[model samples]
Target: MSGSSSTAANLVRTVKVKAEKKVYSLPGQKYAVPEEREPLRIFYESLSKQKPESEMAEFWLMEHGMMSPERAKKAYEKKQKRQKHQRMGTPIKAEISKETSESSRKSSNAKNDQRTKKRSLEYEDSDDDDLIMKPSKAKQK
Candidate 1:
């Protein structure tokens, strides 16, 4: 009996939307802000170099109270990747092959199959290159 679409349309809208920036403050107003990625990355690399095969990077973030355990674990993965780049002395980039396109792959596969068929055809009891040979099938007698 109340708030019909027609009646609602007739009345002026009073819905208020909040556009203010939201802030997250801990119980003691402690803000969990992470340090710059570069410095953290450098520190992580140094720490990793000092003690290889240890999960110190995640604990480092936890010790600093910069992020939660879950988030720290994710950041640790990033730390490991960066450390790998540093240890390698060169950043390995993925190489993109031009002939890997969908149409090219299909056309290349078809061409290879056709060439194999033509080669098989030449061995079918004739040295003549002009004759098209059909592949013989085994028929059960």
Candidate 2:
């Protein structure tokens, strides 16, 4: 029983040492890219050439040490702006004056009020005309 307990104690100590070592080593660990691999280099180079404007190309350049992280980040932001502009189509050059904007808002509010009044009148007329009769409980009995 004593021998078993001693072995268990040794196992626990080894596990704790391993856990501490892992925690300490994680922050300082740097990832080493396999630069010696010709196929991977060629693949990334081809991808970068094919889609120069794409995020994947930027990532490939950054990962392969061809572009710095800061440059990649700027390129990514520019790409995003370009795509957003493309999606939004042409920008309107005409600016509305404050007076015109306020007038338009007032006119729109008036139109909405008129529309609601018309809708309520139509609903009232409809309710009076379409009377759905329900059978009385006395008739059922």
Candidate 3:
């Protein structure tokens, strides 16, 4: 019963407030809130079409409450870096890994070849005429 009476009182106050305003307003605020802005992709798209980045960044900052001008500046700097990379071209991870793997494989093969050559040379040196060996125990006996 008390809940219903409180609800009635609240409804009456809202009705009185609505009478002064031409259109229905939000419960707390005066007007309907605007929707959220699009992502940075849209800003980048606009940028490609000759839109000013700072203006777009300001608009983004307005929409994002936690964002600051400093952060926006940093974001623009990163975008510039990305554009530079795009212009210079970037290698894919797979291509980099493949190149590294091929070079390492070549180096290992070269080292193995060198080791085999050294071993063969050592064997050839062992067969030299001046080579001498200690007598076996049976020979000494």
lDDT of each: 0.63, 0.63, 0.55
Residue 6's lDDT in candidate 3: 88
Off by over 4 Å in 1: 1-63, 92-141
Using lDDT as the measure, name the better of candidate 2 and candidate 3.
Answer: 2
Q: Tens-digit lDDT track for model 1 on 1-141?
A: 667977977897789998875454321112354556768756865776687444565456444545555665565566667679989897855444776677788999999999999988888858576775888999999
Count of clashes, each model: 0, 0, 0
- For model 2, give the 10-residue run with minimal summed lDDT: 21-30
* 62-104 per-residue lDDT for model 2 (tens digits): 5445655567567656556666877899453445699999999
Instruction: Please provide, for model 3 over 1-141, each residue's C-alpha lDDT reduced to its tens digit, 9 standing for 90 to 100.
Output: 689988888786433444665342211222332334556645544553574445454334333432344654565465556558778897323234778899999999999999999999998878565667767777563
29, model 2: CA deviation in Å? 13
TM-score of 3: 0.24
> Which stretches in model 2 have alpha-carbon errors above 4 Å?
1-11, 15-33, 75-141
Off by over 4 Å in 3: 1-96, 128-141
